[model samples]
Target: MSLPQPVPPSWKDLGKSSSDLLGKDYHFHGAALEVKTQTPSNVAFKVAGSRDSKTDHIHADIEAKWTNKAHGLTFTQAWTTSNVLRNQIEVENQVAKGLKLDLATTLSPEKGHKTAIINSVYKQSGFHTRASLDVFKGPTFTADTVLGRDGFLIGAEAAYNVTEGNITRYAAALGYNAPEYAVTVHGLNNLKTFTASYYHRVSRDVEAGAKAVYDSKSTHGGVALEVGTKAQLDSSAFVKAKINNSGVVALGYTQTLRPGVKASFGVALDTQKLNDPSPVGPSHKVGVSFVFDS
Candidate 1:
């Protein structure tokens, strides 16, 4: 019998549980639509468009991907109305077991700018590591690793700027994950900022989470906190709400229109200035999005 492979959190995912619960799918100033389709030739296509409330401009993007599951290879291409094109190629478990490689390049035709990055990830029992290098723009290098055992995780990351000959960024994280709850603490931006997050599944239909941040470099050097909750109203609908220390409240509701269609609505309001005459004081926003998969 073979033992199960240990799963460790990626550097960017150290506080993903609470982060996702608090930040995901809560839009305040945009209306968007997306369509996704799968083709018989092992290809997938996605088209998305959005109208930005602030800019009053419509933006769109088209993306396509071809995947070969047998060989663990994937290729993706994307183009946006902003005159930028991106290409990505990924290989998994081919160079070595438990290893993955990714190469991505982006081109901005109008701006005549191009950039490329190479990344590699390796995972094994009780450990996970990854590294990336920018082929352009100072040829910076970044690496992160995590060690995990019994749901306890510790991870650290660092980045070096080749041109500057210095370490530009460093961060560390500690986390505990359980079947019903997860908690994480991170020292980020060279330990000048600290964050702690917690997530709990109260029941099958209810979930709650919170996040707090203390930034020593902030102008006020104060702690900021936000708490959020998600609840399934029924089989076809769900709702989420969150409030921050600044008296800003946001709420979102999502419903399944049918088997392949879904819609989401969200709003944000400032509680402190609900009756203020000025628009800057009584700020409010609304957003809506629709998705179709076929």
Candidate 2:
């Protein structure tokens, strides 16, 4: 069998600024008008530079997505390109009819990064197994299997990161899963960075989680903690919020207005960035989003 092509570089800044977190379920076709203010998100929307964005980076982009479902197979692709604004493209294809497999690819041309991931799942007589391989500038391989009935599951996985025929990082995890809660511990960079996280379903409509991170490396400034919660307002609406010890808070919400139509709002504030107070005030962002499932 032949393997898939390699991926481009992936970065956080390339994915977040003026982001659209819409999932595919309807035929969406609509554009968003960002009402910018003196906010950090607004500043990030400007001209794309090499590994950093230029000031006054505000611009407009037209994003359109199309999805097709048929014969137990589904395919979806979206593109956002512009000479005046930033460019992003996404493509996804999943086959879940008889055989079970999924392939997702994301590329950022301007940022010079791409990623392709292939996932395969198998279930038989209450035993579940999943295998995944990711291709980027480097390859990451992981395989997981669990045994149980109902929602209770226990599993372990081993992962390896390779670069130039050398092992850069090796990691393993032990996890338990239930209907309402999950726990896992992960170590990375040969235990240079360690993390443990727990998540639980507090109620039918509310879920909460917390994470603890420890860095053996001195450059990370030691330990950090994060807590977050997600709430579903109704069939078509939801809200999420999270905060970290660094005095950073992020809030986001989404609501479906009508059939095949959705809208959203988000804001993020960081107190650490507010030191020395520039004319734009503390680094903050306030924006709106829209998605039309036509």
Candidate 3:
């Protein structure tokens, strides 16, 4: 007998459909640039910078990654302008066929802070699981699992604070995915918030998605709704637009300038506050990002 196939995705990705449509490339408050290059010896380097329009502050980061395909190992080191250094090492399918391990550490010299985390993932036919533990400070532990068969999936996640000896987080999600569409619902933050999301491929060049979130902790127990759509203008270009319950609209346009180079432009407008007088003047924000790879 043949083995069953693994599930489509893990619990953390249950809302990926709405996330991609409503959040992808829609940077409406800052400008950013990124450049990446790889060497022949399996070393890759990346440099990125972003500028906040309101504060006029520029933030930058540099990262280097090395991968060894033979050993199924990868290492990454990164440093940011905030004086924080980070390192991560990953091993895949080494100790076990369907297991992966990751170790990550962060150090902040200016703040005299250090932290570490370890993560493990195991996957098998129709099931997937992940666990992460913080080896520093409160030493929190989190785990999540997903089970799927016939395009339907159910998952749950929880976190425990070892130092405090209490459960800090808990959530559950279920989803159904098909070639043409996907739908997911999640109860998050110990059931304090509930969200539902849907994605549909309307046509060969168009996709639509929507998300609804209800928060029990809100002053009036309100619900927020957002709907978005994406249209592929061509193989190298696409446009997206979305609007939310608060009369805020966002539009994004992305294009591949050339091989290994891409650029995106985004704008946000608040319809209700368009005529309001303020120091910032207009109730709109614009952002752009460029990426280059070699």
Task: Quote each prediction's TM-score.
Answer: 0.96, 0.56, 0.96
Better structure of 1 and 2 per lDDT: 1
lDDT of 3: 0.92
lDDT of 2 at 108: 71
lDDT of 2 by residue, 1-294 (tens): 544322211111111111221112111112234321223322222211111121434445443323233333444343444332222232223333224566767767677566777767655554556666788745877665555444334444555565556554454444555557766565656666777777777899987887778988868576788777778899999888777898876787778888756777666667678664552234655455665433
Scored by Cα lDDT, where does model 1 land? Answer: 0.92
In the predicted model 1, the residue pairs found to clash are none
Cα lDDT tens digits for candidate 1, 188-209: 9999999999999999999999
TM-score of 2: 0.56
Cα RMSD for candidates in order: 1.9, 11.1, 1.7
In terms of TM-score, which candidate is stronger, 1 or 2?
Answer: 1
Candidate 2 vs candidate 3: the TM-score winner is 3
Candidate 3 has what TM-score?
A: 0.96
Residue 286, candidate 1: how far off, in angstroms?
0.4
In model 2, which range of ten residues has the least summed lDDT?
Answer: 9-18
